[model samples]
Target: MIISAIALSLLLFAAGAPAECLGEWSPHVVWHVAKIGKLTSELQLGPNGLLYALCGNKLIAVDENGNKLWESDLPDGSKSGCPVFDARGSIFIPGNALIQEVKLNGSKGWSFKVYQGSSKAAALLTTGPGNLLYMQLPTGLYAVDTAGHYKWMITQWDQVYNASTQLETDWEILASVGNDQAVFVIIGKKKEGYTLMAFGEGGKIRWRYSLGEIKQANLVVGGNGRVYATVNPKRTDDYYKGTVYAFESDGDGSPLWSYAMGCVDLTAPTPSEDGLLYFCADEKLYALNQDDGTEAWYEPLPKAISRPSVDENNMRYYLGTEDKRLLALNTEGRLDWNLTLDGKVSMRPMVGPDGYLYVVTEAGSIYKIKDEAPESDGG
Candidate 1:
């Protein structure tokens, strides 16, 4: 795709956006890292900037040039959630029957079953506040220390703390940043009720808000001192309804604001750097005002969004789709540009530590991409 370079320059200056994010960022592959030729959709860029993936029970780390760093053998059924990194730079995997760890150098670290006498693998694992690992199992979310020891269980959220209040596996966890860094979670049971909880200091509950009965919910820590929560109130046959809410990351009481819409809507919610909450529902992408939950704009989507790219700048939003397309929506909520990939998007497009958009495909390809405004000079 070719565009007038002179006009592009003017657009860049008028918008006051960075060079890379000016307008119509035409995506071109900078390099190819791996081409395993098989579907390796589950890939994660580690803290050290290396791409990590699980092909079967073997965890492999690869560099930018497709060079293999190291491969470690994981226990059988070690595939589910992506690999998570701890503060000490160790990797954790949700194995079928255990919470496994891989050291920084690709060597096996600590491996232990989250729940004894059970073969059910963890549904999700994330590095939470206080340098602890939070694992979602059938019984509830369990906090595990770096040394592979079970620290605590948030099984029954109710104060009664008995068998009757058990909430099961309906919960999601995320950690906030800044001076008052903390952990937040959405936990509850079907029909009974659902609520959001914030943990601070020594894992003690700091605040809670009742959310009625929700089928699913997603929480995310935004750039500022805000926490965003989106929920699917109920699935009404062919249609679904959701409500997006925002809360002060550290303050108490009800949500700062709530907007009806955003949930199948079970995917993790995403917020842009400049304070806009992105929600994909009913085949449309809606951008909401972060402060007041007001609707800014929305664009029709070819398909439901998979994972969203929270670009460093507010100029553009990159979204992965099940339809094998990399979509770029401008601040005005228009699908101005798109790039076709070799296969369906496997992982969310992420801006690596080095500032390049890293996109992984189901065809086992890692693409390092740069977005440049279209130019008159054709490629």
Candidate 2:
């Protein structure tokens, strides 16, 4: 597992390093403090670099430099959950069996309740031509207005799950995947199978694809307006190989293409801005044409490495390994650079708005790697 110094230099460059940070290398570079401790549940960066996190039954807000701003606990008898911020700066958090909206200034906006249980996740969607679409995962899929007024609740798709599993124990809730204009919902039991339902802004089902099995992968939509999903066959005594299905947005049960990955596909694949979809198979990163599921490029890495992270603008791919080294590659599958860390890296490297590479480790350390000093011709 020894990484050469020359290899480390190339990896750093390929990882979207600025010009000033290249050349002469420091054995180990450490940055200032960002945040300590594992995030309680989920962490999201809000508008203007506001960091919001769900810590147990409380919602904590902090500045970019790890300075505490304020923490608001859920109402009297409520428990705190993950919060999602919409495009309009409204914060959505689940409390008291309802999904409540709060402004950034700590003022109550609106609240929506459900008879089944608390909300799992929520997103504010703005459809084409300035239409507002709100989605929440609770008892079922809800379509609502900005003011917390219920426009419609989808009961056509039957969903029922155990009250103890937080919506994943069994197939009790229908999940929505995609942005404002397009959403896909999977409904039905695990053993009995399920169906993929596509919908528009107004609670209309555009199309439905019979999956015939249970799928747990997050729904990914490409720029070409197609839905990419994976299905896993756990039981049912059938030896159906795991496959990734690509379906057109406007069609009815017509699979544009299907690719057999293996026994299962575990990760959610993201389509890059350059019309290339990236997914990890057999400990290697594979880039496929977003237009059609065809291999564009791939790079082999150690089996202990984590998933790949791509910079759509810089056209670089990054992967970290358990050997305390980070690998980088260009869009054409060329090695760029590799860097050694103080310890094993767990969290994914976050590219900040200020063009700094923020890599956080499992041992509670955030390294801000910046360009050391730009070289000059003695001018």
Best by lDDT: 1
Please write out the lDDT profile of model 2 over residues 1-379, one tens digit for every residue.
1111231221122232222212332112333333344444334668757655554455555555444566565553233334656678787765544666767655667877665434343322222212344453434556655567777755435333323334432343334456545667666665777778777766666778776765554456777777777565553244565556788877776788776655453345666788777665566667777666777777776642444566665666665566666666665766555676555554445555654455644544345553222252211
Point to the candidate with the largest TM-score.
1
On residues 1-379, what C-alpha lDDT tens digit does candidate 1 reach at each position? 1111132221111121112232555665666554543423356777787777776677777676555666677775564556777668888887664688887678787886644234343446666666777665545556788988878776654556645643444433221222245666665666566778776645667788887767777777777868887777775443345777888867884899987653446355678767677767666777887879988887787764665766665466777777777777766777766777767773568777666677777766666676655672323
Cα error of candidate 2 at position 327, Å: 4.0
Backbone atom clashes (below 3 Å) for every candidate: 1, 9
**Runs with alpha carbons beyond 4 Å of true place in candidate 2:** 1-37, 40-43, 55-58, 74-83, 94-97, 105-109, 117-138, 158-170, 173-175, 235-239, 263-265, 303-307, 320-326, 334-349, 358-379
So what's the TM-score on candidate 1? 0.77
Model 2's number of clashes is 9
Candidate 2 colliding pairs = 8-338, 10-336, 10-337, 11-337, 11-338, 12-337, 21-371, 160-172, 161-172
Per-model TM against the reference: 0.77, 0.71
Candidate 1 clashes between residue pairs 3 or more apart in a chain or in different chains = 3-375
Q: Which whole-number lDDT from 0 to 100 does residue 363 have in model 1?
A: 65
Q: What is the lDDT of every predicted structure here?
A: 0.64, 0.55
